[model samples]
Target: MGRHRRGARREVTVADLIDALRRYPADMEVRLATQPRMPQEHSIGAIAEADGLVWIGEGRQEGYASDGVAERLGWR
Candidate 1:
């Protein structure tokens, strides 16, 4: 048997996030942080272009349902 090693975590850009959202749609999850920070919300929206918002953390997995699309960036 062999041990598995975690792959290098790449810096996910806005383009990447948008692409993933389009591809997965229902499985995409994200977290956003503004200047003063805001409340926590779970939802994903359509990303047309990259804004000034910084991508603090992001990743994808299974088991998410496509309830509805969000209008702004948020958690999931």
Candidate 2:
């Protein structure tokens, strides 16, 4: 995933996510990668579509991500 470094913020929509996910297997497990400096992760606990938007809940903490995660994410 690339960062938006200019112009108005274009929020990622459910459609966008779906389109991207099409390249992967439907049964693939999804996890949240967060805190780039610390590189933490979490399981996906919930997903809901409401109020015209999709919500992805950052589930339970799965501990620090591998060292390469931060570098790959350009979060360092």
Candidate 3:
């Protein structure tokens, strides 16, 4: 038997994150950092604080029920 190797993790980009939220309209937790850092597999952070939204955290998953976030992002 051969051992399985993990595939390369997908690096989520800022634009991808915006598009996902815009198109999917699903409740998702986001992570934000004050400075530039390594990218995540499926997360994004605001480049500036003025962006208005707060970053959740890494390895944190939460349910997004109401479409509030979608409406806030103008995706609704």
Which sections of candidate 1 miss by over 4 Å? 1-6, 24-76
lDDT for residue 60 in candidate 1, whole number 0-100: 28
Among all windows of 10 consecutive residues in model 1, the one with the lowest summed lDDT is: 67-76
lDDT of 3 by residue, 1-76 (tens): 1112464456555666677668654675454222123222334533443356544444432334235444443345
Scored by TM-score, the top model is: 2
Model 3 weakest lDDT span, ten residues long: 32-41
What clash pairs does model 2 have? none
lDDT of 2 by residue, 1-76 (tens): 2337764457886677789889999999877898766888899978988889888888899888887777766676
Candidate lDDT (C-alpha), each: 0.41, 0.79, 0.43
Error of 3 at 49 (Å): 7.1
| Alpha-carbon lDDT of model 2 | 0.79
Q: Tell me how far candidate 1 lies from the true structure as C-alpha RMSD in angstroms.
A: 11.8
> Where does model 2 exceed 4 Å of error?
1-8
Prediction 2 TM-score vs. true: 0.74
On lDDT, the leading prediction is 2
